[model samples]
Target: MSNGVIVRRGRYYWHLSVQALYDGKTACIDWRSLLPLNGGTTKQRQSLLASSKGLLIALVESPRDHRGERLAHSTVLNWVHDLRRLIRWMTSKDVWSFSDLRVTDIVDYMTFSTMRKDGGGEVAPHTLYMRGKLLHEMWEVRHQYPSPLLIDSTHWILKRRDDGDAVRRGGHLTSQLLFPCSVPR
Candidate 1:
């Protein structure tokens, strides 16, 4: 199927099935299949969920970045996962809109995520990098959404060191050492 979000049963469920740019196979996603929203009133939670779903729809429909190149299917899936994390974090803090998100909140989230335990350890460095990149891309595609993120995320730059470590600065995870083997030089 072409890249787009499909709403079914009067908005109770949404689905997306698109051709993967990397492999040219159908990639199917069921929107209602994600984890349930937590830590907010029903109305607030639903509003945020709706907005996020809209963002996902917009992203899938237009997969091109600033360079007019298509994004890989895996990249889009990663964004979907990252967006869920972002939404959960936002709702936890009572932040309902992207416009309401502050840089410090983002910083706090980055710190919180680093400390988040998965399989008895902190999240991987490459995972953090991907999350940071998602924030940048969210800003890049803000104009495509109905309610857009107002903050400028261009300053959140990711750079590779002389070693095979990826680091972000200027409003992102600052100086958080990444595993050398996880990132490419």
Candidate 2:
């Protein structure tokens, strides 16, 4: 099943739509229009549409029951912008779908974002980490429910880290670090 959004040719404007079949009924999504094919790069426009589709799916699978309806129009538009940026970044690295992501992919994306930029500054590690976390969260929600295909382990480790541990060991648990003044009086 092609989960990514598909480009549809419309009469007046190119309609970006995603068709999800649930219980033998089709859920059709028609996102707001793109500039009449005149202003943006073809790749940019297509990525924009695809990202919109991804967000629609994300909203449905969002932790919040009514994320889509709760967001204001301008906020929704801004989300589209953020989604487009994410898609473009992913596209540059040949990551076009959520399935393309892996543990290594998360590390690589963080590295890419944190590298010194042409503009002379690197993005903060915290920023890169935040983006990775958000993307991972989206992947988590999307896979929690059943899909057309049986979800594999990539989807199962949603709450767990790359390893199976609920709490990462080898921290300062055994140390007197928290009670600093208690050391060797």
Candidate 3:
């Protein structure tokens, strides 16, 4: 609405300055109380901004048949909601910087997000990989931060490892040989 959800720079909480339609008049929804996951330190705040930018880009380029019209807007808004929840969890632990975020933090969040009542919580390895890839995409586009992973393979394996499955599978489908060679004329 208001220039696509204003998350102010250098702020701790995830602020959404929304324009609401009430009684034919415009109003605002203030979510200032929602603090960021690490007190919103400089680095953390920057990371949030970077992630948001990346998500918007993905939404804009999404396939038309996938989500119907207005998919971009809807997808971006959905991402905002997901980010809000992540922020809430981070704030609870007083984490405020990218440096403060450890592999454990990511694992914990993944668990919290995908946990089933039976305690066999799991997020598909592909989904986990995509999430990290999205973040890396954001970082690359924003050009503010360096590579998220110090070593490329570490990042790849971390994203791919799920439920202790030792085999790494590729998501892409390869083309099979369909044409046969003609020898006789």
Candidate 4:
């Protein structure tokens, strides 16, 4: 608990927040620990828990989200697809493992998702938003809670062709458009 390290629970997961001081520069890092590994000998459980990859794989296969509802067919499929993509991305980046995944690696994954020769470009903003939501559902080794990765990735966005110009995002997504203003424009 010392050195500015704090562990706490969110809606369902355990969060480890640590502040690091290096070269007189300070930075904070947060990690979402996975769900507890059960149904094995102490040593076997420990071994599975020790490997972040294994932990992640278990999380992906979990039958339900943190809320305990049975995972929908599409949800499981998305998890499979995304997890595979993540593993491939990890290998391509030569990442040490899942536990060692850094925020930079996450950012890089976002970067990689946007490039392709076919109809693919970047993952849609809504898709990224949904993925962020799902991150909360999976990968809880503690209390089965939300992951900070979801919150962190919410800001992820790719540069659009009109980005340089101040073209506003469409207003249709907001409910304000549903009602007419009292004052005439």
| lDDT per residue as tens, model 3, 94-170 | 75433355555655554565543367765554544444444344334433343232222223224332332333453
Top-scoring candidate (lDDT): 1
lDDT against the true structure, each candidate: 0.60, 0.42, 0.43, 0.40
Query: What are the per-residue Cα lDDT tens digits for candidate 2 across 109-134?
Result: 54455554475686544444444445
Clashes of 3: 5
- Please tell me which model should have the higher lDDT, number 1 or number 3: 1
Task: Give the CA lDDT, 0 to 100, for residue 48 in model 4.
Answer: 28
- TM-scores of the models, in the given order? 0.65, 0.41, 0.41, 0.40
Ranked by lDDT, the better of candidates 1 and 2 is: 1
Error of 1 at 83 (Å): 0.9
RMSD value for candidate 3: 13.1
> Candidate 4 on 1-185: residue-level lDDT in tens?
22112244233333333223223442222112232222335553333234533334345345543454333333434554555555556555554345445555655665565454275675555455444443444434423322222223223332223332334544211100111233122
Those runs of model 1 whose alpha carbons end farther than 4 Å from true positions after fitting are 1-12, 18-38, 63-73, 157-185
Kindly report the root-mean-square deviation of model 1 from the true structure over all alpha carbons.
8.3
Kindly provide the TM-score of model 4 when superposed on the true structure, using C-alpha atoms. 0.40
Question: Taking the candidates one at a time, how many backbone clashes does each contain?
Answer: 0, 0, 5, 9
